[model samples]
Target: MRANEGRESAIRAYTRYETLTGHVWRCACRARMLESEQRTGLVVYVDVSNRLQPPLPSGYFGNAAIGVTATSCAGDVVSKPVGYAASIVRRAIDMVTDEYVWSYIEHLKNQEDLSKFQDVVACGNPNIAVASWMRLPMYGIDFGWGKEVFAGPGSMSIDGDSVILSSSTGDGSLIVAICLEAIHMDSFKKHFYGGII
Candidate 1:
């Protein structure tokens, strides 16, 4: 039909269709496909830099307590078994340790300190901060009712792999969200939602 379509058709006929992620596949035409492009699985981590009123103490606010909001890329949040999702959120929060946060904060503080001293001689920043491994899981966001409007596992940051999720308003609600890279997202969805035959 169109020039690009004709080229794509030729590629499809000759090029192999490799399993890229989950239900998502990739043709030889494209070497790589990012998760954001395919809308398969995503993890977003946003540092809520907004200071709360009354200046919360570091220890009190450091608790991984937050809200969660699950929405499709279309921005319509599905309403079904939200409480179940809430539990998953709580589990994610309970899993993280305070030491990790403190270590990160201290590391950043050191960076700031180094920046201020203009003529500091070089003895490499010997600050070795080790944060234990943390895993973000997304195998539980299942909506058997008429297929979720827009279903996504979760997203997070690269350094900490922090599963960033919006705050949810409900009892026993947790604000943590487990985000995955595009690769993990596809695999996880298949285990939960099955393959697209």
Candidate 2:
């Protein structure tokens, strides 16, 4: 049992390593796209949940997710190492404290024209949005029968977006689903899987 526990711990650490590396790789891909597509600043939004150190009840089902934006110039993101982009992502996420959450709430409440907030982020202009569902019990979800054999997001157009889904094997691995324009998909795939930079 102790050995199994140790193995699981190591696998979890490796999963985290992969996730960070994947994120940086995605950032680099976006930067390359910006240069190819003649776009400007890169605005990356990462979904951050406040449930880690919840200020509310543990079982509260209300939405506790916030989108944290990390902005950088195209040249900076492309020229820097993966660790640099990872650091920017880490800092953006770490800034979401309880106080920051409350402030965001207040800011939303004070909005005069909430319709402006409803506008979806444009896919152009070097934007990337990433949402991770890795920790969710996706495979365990069952309507009445036993655990599901497989589960994942339905097919959708994800141009300029990415989703991290839990692997179906119950192992500490993640399935990153990315969507890109047909023109840029080849380059993105090269950087993503090949670690070209």
Candidate 3:
């Protein structure tokens, strides 16, 4: 696993050698299932009850494996593969993806010969106003609990691993709510409650 900015990161890429025939759906599902199994298995195998951050990208691939030699249920323990299966899988995926990416880059660089250009606009950002608040009234409907005490807009966007939520009152009073994935949700909840977790 590679550490980025003092945080561990694992990037996993899986390639199935079987679908050269171009059956897209099966191939895609297989890859997705493989990734899901890896993620779920490793999370429990490591007993990382309190750990967070999606297992870093480098260690992600170490999770691929065939057969259910073991089982993990909630907090229950079960047999696990020998050695760092998750880590090993992760490395293999990264190596393969890196090779592919580099090969493609090299091929493009040789053909397009655009390496001389310093500033290239990949795509111009189209100005789009995201109105998530328009969906706010829908939330109360989901819970089947009738309308909320107040219907207002929540201003927030996900920034990397963090989520910034803007809370506004009917009177236009505003507050910021910072959130992170599962583990950090509690902290954000506390902040959201503002003294009532």
RMSD of each: 19.7, 6.8, 19.8
- Give the per-residue lDDT of model 1 (tens digit) for 1-197: 01122234444322111111101111100112222323211121222222333335665644333221222221111121222222322333333344544564576577936655554222111100111112233234566664344323333344212222222232422232323345454443443233222
TM-scores for all candidates: the values are 0.21, 0.73, 0.17
Task: Compare the candidates by TM-score and give the number of the best one.
Answer: 2
lDDT of 3 at 132: 15
lDDT tens readout by residue for model 3, 1-197: 11112323463322121111011111212222223333222111121212322333544533321111121221111122212232332333333333444464476668756665444321111100111121132233445666566433353343111111233334433332322234434543443244211
Clashes of each: 17, 0, 12
Instruction: For candidate 2, report its TM-score.
Output: 0.73
lDDT of 2 by residue, 1-197 (tens): 01122334443223343335335445545635556433332233433354344556656675568776766666556665555555556667667777777788899999998998786674443666666777777776679988776677677474656667778876786777766667776667666655532
Ten consecutive residues with minimal summed lDDT in candidate 3? 123-132
- lDDT at residue 22 of model 3 (Cα atoms): 13
Decreasing TM-score order of the candidates: 2, 1, 3
Query: Judged by TM-score relative to the true structure, which candidate is superior, 1 or 2?
Result: 2
